[model samples]
Target: MQADAYADIPLPIDPSALAALIGGTTAGVGILDTKLRYLYVNPALERLNGIPAAEHLGRTVADVLPEIDAREDMMLAVLSDGMSREITSSGRTPAATGADRRYWHGTYHRLEVAGQVVGVAGIVLEVMASDEEQRRLDRTRHHLSLLDAANTRIGTTLDMDTTCAELVDLVVPGLADFATVEVFPPDVAPTVRPAPPGVFRMRRAALTAVPGLLERFARFGVAGDYIDHQPGSAVPRCLASNQLVVENLTDDEQLGRVAHCPERVAVYRALGMHSAVFLPVSVRSGPIGVLGLVRAGGSPPFTAEDVVVARELAARAAVDLDHARRFTHEHTIALELQRSLLSEPRPPHPHIEVATRYLPADRQVLVGGDWFDVIPLRDGRHLKAMGDVMGHGVEAAVAMSHYRSLLRLLADEDLPPHRILEQLDRMVERSGLDRAATCLLAVVDRSGGMCQVSSAGHLPPVFIEPGAAGARLGDVPAGPPLGTGFGGYRTTEVRCAPGTVLFMYTDGLVERRGEDIDVSVGRLRELTLPADGSLERLLDTVLDRFGPGAEDDIAVMTSRARPAPGGCAKDLV
Candidate 1:
């Protein structure tokens, strides 16, 4: 009477608990070993599978699953690693008498008992009401475009965490419902919730402190344990056996106690979500916390794809989360090192106020080569420069730092801006660093209201003063970017009016996939003259259209010349 590894696991939760957890009172769930043998069969699983628990006992999944043509690896994985899997058409396979077989998606969780891994627990559901017959085949046709967008989007993200979040956003909604992430330090409880506000920061803090908990969760058979904080007390569940609850709130005391329903009588009240579902967003690795997704109230139910999407997103999210934590740690060190290399802008000479913001390229360990600095010469002249190396990310960042240092040391020397570039070019080229970069440098004087600007393969600075609006400095661009072998440099003198503001940035701001420098230049002209606006606010709103965060990385530096007495000073924020 000895049943194999499939024996001895607990049965499904009682009817009361089940209704409290699942939003709708309809489905069933069960457990089976890698050999496809029934381990623990729930009453719901029996109802959906059309086989009574008494009959399914000790039977293999193949013998009982009439649907899945089981894969051997997926089977072994259940017992060996406690990995979960999905089979979407299980409900339709065994055509029930009269009712016929409705479609159901199945979600599985690897189960562990004793010190040994054993089987898999599963929940089945009818999903995707709009699906056509050719579901799997139809998705294949869109793979190329999906791959292109995925590759480009994923590649562009410099930060690992951003990349993961982007991935989840891209896949969910269409693929599943809400996606939640939880990260925690070793031996600590996860503190996070989707909220009225302030929740994002809490989630971030948990991840930063715990290094690789996210990534490790993706691999099968993570080792650890789970604790259920029940009202009566608490119970510990095996690491491999994730605890899942499905509850329809209509007749549930626990649901009432939790106040699961808020707008019980509202016309726009949520449905299908009247049923509640709770599961750990965690794996056995370290202490990544639980993720709970509550369905909309008065809704039908949580389908198989719903759970599948959550798990897959969780798998991908794990990579992102770990990377974000690690990246944060690393960025702190790099930013600290970089700050010392950059220049401190001189106080506005009673005429100018300047605000500068620098963002490192988003991906890779390589620092970006974008750099900016403001220097006040002994002659009371202001020196400003912004540059972008050919590549983005950490390596570019390191190079940018190096160039900033060299330029800082040269500022005190009696060299012209052109000569500085010539020397820096030789340094970059001969250093054999193989890194190429572009730069725009300018000099301004408060007393003279005169300006000098030079460019080396960089976006020309936008010059805006009262009345004249934005003008491009430097008639002829200086030689090739610093790292380019054959290059030239030129300078132009401009009579800048007092109260003029000069905006300089790396090419990132004006660059789009197919547009040229002229397009951005034309657009900038239109933007600057916008009847009225603060330079900072304008910069914030306009640049963001094609700038960082939602787009590519951007570096900006703005300096304005003061207004002359008796002249109408244009007040701009």
Candidate 2:
């Protein structure tokens, strides 16, 4: 039989009889003209659309039934091509009949008058399947979209709290009204033994809610708050068994069993919380945390499918957490080792007070081998040294220690700055060490009121005078970096005024990608220093302006020439 054979009746039938025949049926029948304007609708459609038949006539689907989201274009295509199409549409009813939401499976066909396509007709069947299946596929596409978005939303950073915050952000207002996450402290190692049958101490890493619920429950416990899970609570049970636990919070008796305290029970009731789910986050070693979610307001309780999706989200989060945990562990160990290797510089001489600072890259795991030292020599002279090894982490730090020790041995020989660098280069090359470094040496003669500075491919020293507009760059002869075996180094001498500040630093302080080194150097050259501030303040200003974007380690050292007492200079060194 043809799909629209019933519409081929010879003449219009009795309206009362047609209404009686289809009124009791569960299907909705409607007709429209070639322009896709509604012509007739039965009583069933009136109930389905919650609009009177008179209001539907001569109106497009976009008009009276705009909320249905029905594909009227497909129905119009059937009129022109004389083909049929079937689809399912889900939406809320019009405002007239309580505006209930529903889903309908609809079949549309061409309505023909003689041989000409005049209009289209439709038969819509309300999809009243078993309630479980209805909710499961409420819209399979919606569920899939959430899962797809989880990849980008979760695990954006290695930080533990950030990952948890991303997880809760994804589910709230879309999956539930309130979501929270609690995890063992990063210091706690994951173990196979189950938690004892009592309150387990855990850090609440993240807690969030939709605007409707945030103001009410955000005070009980917030992110970074520590709480103990009740004995045999869903969180501990879920962690122990690695299974999801779902509980209804609306039931008083059930709430008493699930909630740890009476105050919690009262809060749930006040919020109209209907249901909650606890999902365990685990890795290869064992369980580490739990993700908790609660639905309130008019939202329905979580279903079995929700459990599956929540578990998938938890699995992704657990992997990120595990990776972060391992990275943090390694970073901590390397930091401790570097600190142990690099001790503070020696005390400064009376004529020249010195200050030094070391800064590691903010975003990197390893601490690079950038170091500085102040060595007091005879005749009130101070030797200021700053250098940067080629690499990062433990090996680079160890190499830096060797370079500092070798320099101390050479300093006792009283060699000039360039001659000392020449010998150090030969020592490193003959030692067959693979690492390389850039170094700067400045010998300050306080009694003579002068400074002799040299550089081994390092940045120049900055000169700041008390009455000058800003700091000025000193002219220092550049030589090949250490370990290059380059013996060509020339020294430069500059007359220093009393109270002149000489600053030296590693390249990491100014070098950046796609920028000229001279431009970076000029920024330091134009900085104005406080006339009477402490050396600590001067160092702070320099680093604050230029240290934020450094991709490698940084070392900075400063020395100020002190005034001679009794207006008499000591015998020139």
Candidate 3:
């Protein structure tokens, strides 16, 4: 039949033909009057709703399918504007043919006669199977995205607290409404014993929550505070079993049991928290801690898929926490070793005053091998030394101690500055110390009124006259660094007037990347000397000027000869 002929067939169509067409198609078809009351329902729609046609006619959608959200508002919009509308909805129906929750796509259009509003015509198709598959794919993609983000955001620093904070920050308001990370104390080994039956202790490392809940949740425990989980708590259970514990707090009793405390239960009620999950943070060693995730009002209870995502996140965070713990332990041991090796220098003779300062590099870098010492020599003279081993960490620190001990033994020989460095270089090379070192040495003879300075691939020493306004770098001869077995070192004699200050330092104080060593040294020489002639104040000013920018370990020492009483040098001790 032609399209125009089909339209001209009749003003009121045959009911049997329309029924046959609606019944033959798979889509569910229905007609609702202006009041949204069902006026007609075909066999397909009856099957979709699990109700016969007689039971659906003359009843509203809410009366027939209360569980399903038919979106009456969209149907009303179609009737008011005579416009068509489409919607995708999900809910359980009486049919129970597939998943508990089924999806459907529906299209609704206005039905009018004589250009006056009459009713709405709706056709719906069951999309449960395909929509379920699409939902699974979307969830998988979301989980993968979270894992990828964890790789870069978590463990960005080798610090325990920082790693903990990163883990919680990544999960809050995305995976959970609130999250917390708590770990066994440093002195307590995670695998040593099962959690106590009465109470379990763990230190809170990090906590984060959705806006408006952070401050309230923080009342339970802040980071660094020790929290004791009461008996039968999910955290303790998760730790002991090394598994996940999920709680759906649907009632006051369930909330009380999961909260483990009356105060927390009240907080939960106020915040409308209804679901929680506790997962063990574990590695090959054992369970190290627990990760807690919670969801509040209107948010769905934790599901199996959510548990899977949270478990993966906890596992990744566990590895990072383990690494941070190990790093912190090593850093502590190295720092102590360096400090012990760099003890205060021995006091020089009464005529000589000396001051020294040692600063390790930033926390990200391990302690380095920088050392300073002052040793008394024969004839009222003192030997001052500053040296830097060419690396960082425990091995460099050990080498530094070796150099310091060997230098003390050679100082007893009353050797000059150059001879001392030559002997040190030979001994270090023979001792199998592979790391090279730069060193500056000065022999101050107060009565002789002259100081002998030498260098072993080290920076030149700076000197300030008693009354001079500015400092000047000493023109000391340089040689190969210690451990090279080179003997080209030559001593430069600088006049040591009464109250003259001799400053010696390692390269960390004056070296900058991409800048010539000479230019860096020039910057140091241009600094005005402190007028009080106090060696302590002189070293303080130098550090205040350059210490903040140093990228390596620094060791600096200053020595000044005191003027003899009555202007008679021979009378001094």
Candidate 4:
């Protein structure tokens, strides 16, 4: 049978009977001409549209029910194809009924006479409750997706500014048209006490907005700028009350009050921002800052659902910010401690020129335990010591201090370099300092033209002759690292020609990942000394060649015995 075979059959009911049936039923029924102007509307439709039947005639659906999306496109499509279409639409209508917005399910079909299309007919029924439920489900799913994105996007680094930027980027053009994150300055602590009624201060950490509005919004404040909120402003109120503050800026006065400043009010008006939500970014450490969300022209005011999601996002971001805060605090203390403990070594004898350099690892790692010291001894000899404790951070740095103090005390006894290492190792073990360390000690005797060297599992020192083409590595005997409770260290003597330079450094100066230790050390041995033979210039050349790629902390020291008064030159050693 043909799809439209039933249309050829005659119906027992006539036009009057069909009109009475549609008019009497509760569902709305309407008919339109090819121009989509309504020709007939039953009493039910008049009630649904909140307009009388007489008023609806000769008017299009857009004219009578302009507030609702009645899907006129579907009617036109049905007229073109001679098929029926069912659609569900929701919007506000003039219906003074229950809710501000109403939903309806409608089916549209083409009307034909004499095998030519003349008009369209529609049946509509309200499906407000069921449609609302589906909308809620969809909104819930969208919220979950946003939260999942937050988890991956925010807190990727332990940096406060980066995290704040991530948070604002996630919500703009999705949850809001403009967003900002402001935090307390590092020197100030988050306090629960009510702020003074006159002014509230916070540093702007980040901000983001839709394309055209970002520049306009940035005129009010930029990141790292300190912003002050008025007494009754939304931000201060949100912080004081520990709750979200939603403002619909319906008038100039409302915008002024929420903006906290006249300049901001002008910007808000220019940008057409009419709605805002202020949420406190807080954790167990009281309220740290505030997050501001805004929506501009044509955007609906914030709803209760938006508040719930904004609260959750703020909570998650707060946790990450707190972690960053703590990390920053700890890092500052460690850096201070490392610097204080590693102050410039006391000036060695005027004849013995000393130059030193210390560089910490990258920001991701804390300060490490590399240290150097120059100690003046009897008989015109100066002891140059370089050592590295086995770890990074405060613990290793503190252990380095202990080892330096012990070495200085032992140096006062004027013992041989090997015996000093043996006694220092025993003292560290007995004192229960668990961290092991590698150290190289070189005692230069200018008057005798000889230097005694000892090693405790450390790299050999490099020696540069006054005019040599390349540097030579000292052949000091190796011993177990300090604090290992081993006492078999031996001392070696090397000829210290006048104007010869001795370079000592920690392992970080030459260590490279995935490369043999000998190869890494060889790269340093192949370098020529500066033509001027300046100790400072020699150290600079070494650092320039190898310092940029070092992944660990480095401490380097260079000392050269100048030509002694009335002393003749000796052969290179």
Of the candidates shown, which would achieve the greatest lDDT relative to the real structure?
4
lDDT of 3 by residue, 38-88 (tens): 777777787888887777766789898888888888889898887899978
Candidate 1 off by > 4 Å: 1-181, 185-287, 293-344, 348-350, 359-367, 430-432, 469-473, 485-487, 527-534, 544-551, 563-573
Error of 4 at 46 (Å): 6.6
Tens-digit per-residue lDDT, 24-115, candidate 1 = 43555655654556655555566666666667777776677656444545556555665567765634445355544456676777666565
Indicate whether candidate 1 or candidate 2 has the larger lDDT: 2
In the order shown, the candidates' Cα RMSDs to the true structure are: 19.6, 10.1, 6.9, 7.5
Query: Would you estimate the TM-scores of all the predictions?
Result: 0.51, 0.70, 0.74, 0.72
Return the top candidate by TM-score: 3
The order by descending lDDT is 4, 3, 2, 1
lDDT of each: 0.55, 0.78, 0.82, 0.83
List the pairs of residues colliding in candidate 4: none
Question: In model 4, how many backbone clashes occur?
Answer: 0
TM-score-based ranking: 3, 4, 2, 1
TM-score of candidate 4 relative to the true fold: 0.72
TM-score of candidate 3 against the unseen true structure? 0.74
**Clash pairs of candidate 3?**
none
What's model 1's lDDT at 442?
77
